[model samples]
Target: MSVNRATMQGAFDLCELFQMGGVPSIIAGGAARDIYFGVRPKDIDVIICGISMETASEILAGAGIASTPFHIYNGAASDRLVGGFKLVGTDIDVCLYDCTDVSEAIDAFDFNLNQFVISGIHHGIDGAHVRFVGEIHWSTLAAVRKDFTPARHDKMQAKWLDLSWRRATGEAVEVPVGGLDGPY
Candidate 1:
């Protein structure tokens, strides 16, 4: 789909929502990459930190979003899959996690945001401005060792390996994180 201003705005709105009340959330999955590239995302993945999975669900529910049951399959904490309203048809995946999980992810992941080059300036509701920072997720996962299915891992590895080869050949490289492997 063609990227547009509204797409970026939705992401900004979600970011604001989390910052104003959600607290300690990291934009992950598609939203993170899309925002970084000045595009709107089909889904917004908000990884919540600092609250119990149940408490996070309650908070999300109060905001008119419904929480999905916690599952061991997704490798996400507790997720809230939301849609409709002004964000109709868009998926808002809220992954609620504890503070310790967030900290550990930051500490262990080699591709974590803590190790990336982030620019402060970004597009927002008011055009180009310095409103948010681009966070990298791979390092965080590498640190935390959040596993995925092997098939998924293989697919992701193939992509990364391609990029790495390109980089070796003097081309720009974009890193990837999600894939199969782990307990998921």
Candidate 2:
């Protein structure tokens, strides 16, 4: 994907905000990838290693940021895995870090670019720090920069899945809260 300025600025601003808490945040999932390519992510997934959900919730509560358990999961209904929190209106989902380190976490994603971590992001998580898999496909990535192509269409379908997920979970889709909320 072709990097752009606005998205880069957004990543820096987000890092600035995260650093305010004085905690190391692992930017995971597709959000990391989007930030790498200078694409403003629809939602942000952050992971912290040393904090419990209760502690994290308390911190956010003290900061006036409403947070609740992130209900989205990929496994069976009976399985309770990876407790996380979703900050209301901010599109931020904070997950409790597991044994999987940032390196392994990034590799679990569907795409190469989605695999990354900007370690020790202080008051400034610059775009230059965005890491990725050793390999990259310029042509496929470039297609993401273009508008209304198959990639975009495929993304739209993926957005539909999110909408379905929300509906199934009794959650409402909102641009501020994170759903399909862009050109898609």
Candidate 3:
């Protein structure tokens, strides 16, 4: 599979926008996994580090990006998600973490595949852009190439099965993993 141009462009543009707003962020989770596999991401997940949800909301709103609060309900406990925004035909979900660096946020991911991130975005007036950054976890590369998911949580087993099937058949399959949001 080849990289999806539109999805990647949207990710890059979002990173640039956040950078311009002086808020450091990175694209991670399923979106990064898809990008590494040369597949178009279903949606882009952004991790905004070292900021409160209110501050992040202000930055997003200032950039003309309207976002809605996202929450994951797990029984009696409801997990509040940062925000969900749409940009360039792509759904971008933002997660606010109280961390100083993108790596810290990436470390909170449950699986290695979702741990990969796109960072170090550089925008230039001369059109010399260098958007790709961050190292791909070895386990993530192995899982995707070998069509297997490393043992982590028992709940994620089905997700691996669906991923394998998707890879073999080239079909998009949605497997609900009990509202498993990335990195809180």
For each of the candidates, the C-alpha root-mean-square deviation to the true structure, in angstroms, is 9.4, 12.3, 10.4
* Worst 10 contiguous positions by lDDT, candidate 1: 175-184
Ranking by lDDT: 3, 2, 1
Question: Which has the higher lDDT value, candidate number 1 or candidate number 3?
Answer: 3
- The Cα error of candidate 1 at residue 37, in Å, is 6.5
Q: What is candidate 3's TM-score against the reference? A: 0.59
lDDT, candidate 2, at 45: 65
Model 3 misplaced stretches (Cα beyond 4 Å) = 1-4, 71-89, 123-155, 159-184
lDDT per residue as tens, model 2, 6-42: 4434434444544466644566656654544435567
Better-scoring candidate (lDDT), 2 or 3: 3
Better of 1 and 3 by TM-score: 3
Instruction: Show pairs that collide, candidate 2.
Output: none
Q: lDDT of candidate 3 vs native?
A: 0.51
State, as a TM-score between 0 and 1, how close model 2 is to the true structure.
0.50
Compared with the true structure, what per-residue lDDT tens digits does model 3 show for residues 1-184? 2234454555567677776777777767776655444445667777777667677767777877767765333311121233444433346667765567776666555445465555433532122221223244332232222323345444455554545443564333222111132111
lDDT of 1 by residue, 57-171 (tens): 5665677754565544444342222121223344555555435443333333223322222121133334332111224433122322354456755655654443333224432
Candidate topping TM-score: 3
Superposed by TM-score, candidate 3 places the C-alpha of residue 121 at a distance from the truth, in angstroms, of: 3.2
Query: Which parts of model 2 have CA positions greater than 4 angstroms off?
Result: 1-24, 71-81, 107-113, 123-128, 133-184
In order, the Cα lDDT scores of the candidates are: 0.41, 0.47, 0.51
Ranking by TM-score: 3, 1, 2
